[model samples]
Target chain A: MELTNYVVLATILFTIGATTVLLRRNAIIVFMGVELMLNATNLALVTFARIHGDLTGQVLAFFVMVVAAAEVVVGLAIIVSIFRTRRSASVDDVNLMKS
Target chain B: MTDSFVAPTIDWIYLVPILVVLGTGVVGVLVEAFVPARARRTVQVTLALLATAASFATIVLLWRDPAVQGDPATGGTYGVRVLGGSMVIDPFGLAVQGVVVLLAFLAILVIADRTSTGQDAFAPTAAAVPGSPYEDLARRKGIEQTEVYPLVLFAVGGMMIFPATGNLLVMFVALEVLSLPLYVLSAMARRRRLLSQEASFKYFLLGAFASALFVFGVALVYGYAGTVDLAAVFQVLAGGGTPFADMPGLVLTGVLLILAGLLFKVGAAPFHAWTPDVYQGAPTPITGFMAACTKAAAFGALLRVLYVISLGMAQSDPAAQEDLFVALWVVALLTMVIGTAVGAVQTDVKRLLAYSSIAHAGFILVGIIGFSQASLRATVFYLLVYGLATVGSFAVVTLVRETAPAPERALVDATAGVVAPGGESASAPSAPTGGDPVGDDPSPAVPDAGVVLGEATHLAQWAGLGRRSPWLAGAFSLFLLSMAGIPLTAGFIAKFSAFGAAIAGPDTQGGGSTWVLAVVGVLASAVAVFFYVRIIVLMYFTAPAEDAEGVGVTVVRSRGPAAISIAVCAALVLVLGVFPSPVLELAAEAVKFVP
Candidate 1:
């Protein structure tokens, strides 16, 4: 059972997104990283479902997108409010949450 | 794609509790937007109570229906395949739903009392227009703000669905619905001192950051597993730690990082730096609710991920899973030690309790460490016990009656409303406890009665507490004892179950742990005893603080509903402690979901 190359590429892209989230300071960039990761996941789900000849993976991916959309809207609203309140969005600059 | 075209069918019945909560949140937001200030209290509170009780009743009725002929969900562990085989329902999800039902009910009680009592006094207006009366003034009290309650319930409902969801995407949605309101509400305390606002702000900012992390993690796992259905992932991972066999190493890191983000929401160590500040800064009641309910919800989801996924990881090599378990055990260990030791040294009552909660998380982690298919009973039982105690402890703290406002920067949440500016709110006449800069006192031996006399002493001093608040005191003691793990208390039974499970080892068909960790946990608990006893000492041994430095100490009186919440939690703690079989049996019953 040979694994597909598409799966491997999608995973590498996902890793980049995750790393950006860990290392990036800019909130939007971090958010973009998250988006990239999510897109990578959708690709993997669709590709695997194609390989396995099962539709479950494809359906789950669709739901993931729907959720991603909701998260983005809410995330934007939260970031907007934090900016209004704290006047900044850099993960480190938002010191109001620290212990 | 064609499968999605069929439009994944959702079992509406399975989502009833979630819908009810969402409806409640919508109602709360509506009231916050449109209701007259004075009338907002009644509307938001009644709506919240009704929603919780109704959902609770629905859950109860689920059990009452004839098992054979009743609805498929009511009869067996009810499940609706929202996305065909991508997700399914098991009793594990249902058990968490039950925990949510209880948590929602308890949160309403705490929220209602705090809001009602603080009418005309909410968070102080920090950074108010300068050259104002507040320039030299400290934090102000808050006005009633029950609107946050229903919104919180909505989130709770979402969180409840989170662990139950078969799909990662749905789980993510549930996580957001549960968390967003909390981030907002943490900032809404009445004593809008800087600390309160800071608490909420930090909670929001960090919480948002964590959510992003979790989202990315999910995407990575989706990439590796190619589906979000937990069961399907189990099938994939069942081959062992090598579940992601063909995927690039990057995908595995994504899964672990996403887990880190989820763990943050649960306030597990390393990610837990935010716990103490937020707990200390938020209004005591809100702190309690968050500590208890939200933590439970987080753990519920965490358990599902580990047991459902990692169990397969464990099968790869029991020893490898053991190593993974060991890694988590270290995190939990640090959390327990840090939380307990720091909590023990706090001069401020709230700060002390916050640390104690941190320590408790470690104990819960102890149960979590044993998360094999067998660790299910231990984990679920421990959560039930630990969750109740956490709620109970917070209930006591909430009832203690705050004396001062947070720093001005703390009340910054109102600035974000963007709709109506929070108007001026009158302060509470005077706090029974001292929370401000105190002048030198003549009484040299006088204990910080506020710190010592925390449990029922505040109620005793200002609001007819000792006699009128006898019931509240009893309930408070029950919770206090539970935290103490006293025999015949729920806390005792819960702690026992977790430790027992942890010690039971991986094959025990319950939560198991290394004896070394469990013993360390026990020793750490002895340190916890010192603090729990401190509260009890204040309640029983210490005299109430009198007009020390002209700061009068009037006890707060508990209202009927508020008192009832305490009474019920206390009674159950004792009931479970006295006769552990039934509850423990139920915990054992819930373990089937583990494998």
Candidate 2:
């Protein structure tokens, strides 16, 4: 398979993830969408690294994974605290301040 | 083919400032783990402040280093690249680092301050549900939030690294490192827990999305240039070192995406959906810190990126350069209009300040669009003065509190036939018992600790503040006037330099269209003045709202730190306004980026 095809696949997944983040009501699901978008970027980075014959992209992917894990730790902790108080994880329900 | 591994030689001395800050953060975390709870706040505050001070001293040392000063004959500054060119300590980056450290120190003072009641701004137990028995128990036990100091130090460390890096990967890491602590901090407000958490949730999700786009943009740029190093990418764009140079579409798309991420941090319009909400909901001190330091760091990074891309495009693709200019122009115009128009209507003090910050971001963008050394100096100066005013204003906000009414006093005043200044019967049954008999005294009877509520953020609550506490009102008025760009205040000089830079224009670019932004910025300042002046009038001219309902504003006496921060900020604003040449010269000297 052509390497460009990998980029195309990544783009499709990224779109799906972005759309989910915008449209999904559940905060957890929205966070999952963020994760998906990140993973899609990882795929693209690795593919680009293969094409470039350099280690930078691969190293960046590893960094992204670590950051994503850190995000999960902070995100889940915040979500759980909010969930305990309101008994709901819906983003719409979280609206206390008028935007 | 097997290759022998070679470790990259590092410059340890040049990396000292960043290391000291990040190192302090790690030790701070260790302090949290090992130190006894009673002694933790003192230890952490001392460590964080001293480390930040030491870091600033190192930056000063670097400034004087002959290597950094470069050759006097050339009249050019040199940047030191460390860690295989991942980080660059250039004049511009160093100046920004200094600004961030200075602002962070002041913000930490506000964050560390407790009211005379011995209540700090953070929740006793952040994990406990608001209003729950556990929360009450923690509150009663007076369990101080010693952990906040460490979190703030880590955030400050990330902020220092953010503007100094030349590698996209490292920038991404720095972005996350800075943002994560802030997300946690936003959720830890002692009052308005729900709003705080919601702000944190929104900030995290949106921040994550922006960074995702940023990383993807890095991937695309890497695909085109075969490297994530900014200097390398610039070289490829300028000299066509890559086969993909012909595909400007991919590179431009990536550049815009990366810009989106940076713009989000700066709270520019179209990407600023989170700023007002987050600023309004976060604890006031954290809001002040985020507003001042984050914007400076983001602008520093943005300036570097724009300089590289524009310089490269000038050499290789003038058409692309024009396109970039047009894009920036539109964002600047939109940001000014939205910030001014929307900000004029906000009733909540915090939200009003948030919108004002947005407008200020637009003014800074005006300086940026000029794309010259003069503009760069002006932009840096604007950031410094704006930061001082913001931190000072928010510090003032932290001291203003809402007092619950004392029912007995209301009845007593009613029978006495005493009427307050606003024609509202001062004697309404709901008047606070601890309140003075006249009801006009700005100094409320220091209510019992339990009765004192959160910040008096409602605009109506601030009525007749000048009559209550003249010194605080006077200080707050100075910040507002400075923000309004009135004469003889720091803000006026800042606005003047920024607009002047835009009007002067860079020699390479036709600066005609950029002047339109300056005109619009001036007009926006006029519109912005209305709101700022309205607040001043409300504070000094309007009568205190009839507290017959018992929710009057009271100025809480700080133990010491917040007051000192405010006094320093106010004094600096006046001094900078009066004599800006020294700082302007400093900025002029520091305008070069390492590229």
Candidate 3:
């Protein structure tokens, strides 16, 4: 039951993130969505570790969290800078690097 | 998080390079966050340089350690299996990584120089002369470009980890490690305005999707194999007792999905639609770095996944594997054909090379299809040749960006910054053109060039570069030649080795596949020559368009790191082209830990 609940929660968070990333206009909001997905992955990883009775999974999860944290710090900084320069965070509003 | 599990002992000696890079990156960020804006550039460049040098030292140490020699066990093939079976240390990983790091640094140098025009090379002045608009231009375009180095190091750390990762989880981490920074960096180009941001967003969305696909594939493969250990998968296939036919569909699906994800990273044909736009829009340095390092790492993982984990199954069930190979062959050929055809017509240098890289990916995959762990030696060899040449090409591209005087700053301030009394400024001071006894005027009567910045087109701006900066032009020419695979250059040697290795197929210990694909590879490469030379002809032979700025003349001069990076990269390409054995031998032995 515990395992199932953890997975369900992870799924819910991931879905929410996906929806926000797809639907939101704010670039920062999309970034938040990305963060949500990353966090969901972390939770899922820990849940798997509990199920497996192994600490390796947990260690791996720790690294994931570290990486995710770094990413957010950098991503948020970049987004903020872009916001200041371009003055709008909407995806539709920004179209510079498009291929 | 768990006390019960015996923690794997940390090997700082092996991991020292990574730590050094991360440490430097963090320091660089702090430097940015805390330092006054004027002094930040010095902190950024110095921190980046020191970190790179330290990590490079660690890499040298890691490369020399006898323990990592030969084919050490990979943490296992399922990519999620821990420790031994997923990632194997070998010359291939080390060689590719070195290429990645070197390429990353070159890009840092390029962005630094190109974006810092007119301002003090390192530090930015806080205020501008009244009515002159010099300060305003700097704020809008030059100096303030301190983020380049930190982002470069961060990307290097990711590239280092990308290929060295021993497990699927680590691989995913490595992918994002490099990618997240890239997504942000993409939006920061100084030219092409909105298109740069668009590249970042598109790359982010696609990259995220690919990551999702990759993870799902890993889960499926784990589910089917009942083990994430690559060795176990190999053992199951090679040891011969397990019945693989029972779940052929699952295995096939898992492998394909995994391939798709890796392919996305490499910008292989079906997934390569974004290359042209992104390369054209973002800062040239970043594009060069992404094209070389990211492609190398992605291919590194893909090579390991397909060749190492899936080979056993392929050998066991030759039909399934051969069918898969055939499907891939079609894609490779199509990519080659399309890339060559498209590249030939491109007027933009960045877009042309973008297509060229796409074609090169196709050629490299052909090398992959011809490779097997049994002939693993050749695979690594081809990767080296390909990796070096690709980075070398991008380095040249960075050098070609035109340098313009900073749109901000009084010539007097710039002169003071450069030819100051003692050269004791906290950063790289601008060339003090202030000694120009002739052009020194403090009058707004000239009308601020900043406010009238109506059409400072890159191409039009660079029309008379030969007359203005012949040294930059000459260096760019060598780079283009090297890129074109001309004789007496590293590109030629690199391409020669790849083609030779591919045709020799697998291990060339007397008996190999005789490289039937060499002819096709050669022909495709010949097709590529049309465009490589076309760009050269245009650059060296054609005159800048009349009145310039016909939407094509966009030449932005690089001042600091970008200049140094181009010089270094160009030197390396020429040097390596003439003398290729030492690096090759080092790469040959980078896998001692793979037993």
Choose the strongest candidate by DockQ: 2
Fnat for candidate 2 (0 to 1): 0.61
For model 3 chain B, the run of ten residues with the poorest summed lDDT: B437-446
Error of 3 at B294 (Å): 1.5
Which of candidates 1 and 2 reaches a greater TM-score? 2
Give the residue spans of candidate 2 off by over 4 A: B1-5, B74-77, B406-450
- Best-fitting candidate, scored by lDDT: 2
lDDT of model number 2: 0.85
Flag regions of model 1 displaced more than 4 Å: A1-99, B1-8, B30-39, B63-82, B85-87, B114-146, B239-244, B247-255, B316-320, B372-374, B402-474, B508-513, B545-548
lDDT of each: 0.61, 0.85, 0.59
Cα misplacement distance, residue B571 of candidate 2 (Å): 0.7
Taking every candidate in turn, the Cα RMSD to the unseen true structure, in Å, is 8.1, 6.3, 9.3
TM-score of each: 0.77, 0.93, 0.75
lDDT of 3 by residue, B318-425 (tens): 666666666677777777777888887775667777888888787777667666442243345445444445554554454433222343334333321112222212
| Candidate 3 chain A TM-score vs. reference chain A | 0.86
lDDT of 1 by residue, A8-94 (tens): 777688779778877998777877777777787777777767766668668767766876686676566555544444445666654
Worst 10 contiguous positions by lDDT, candidate 1 chain B: B436-445
Docking class of 3: incorrect
Candidates sorted by TM-score, best first: 2, 1, 3
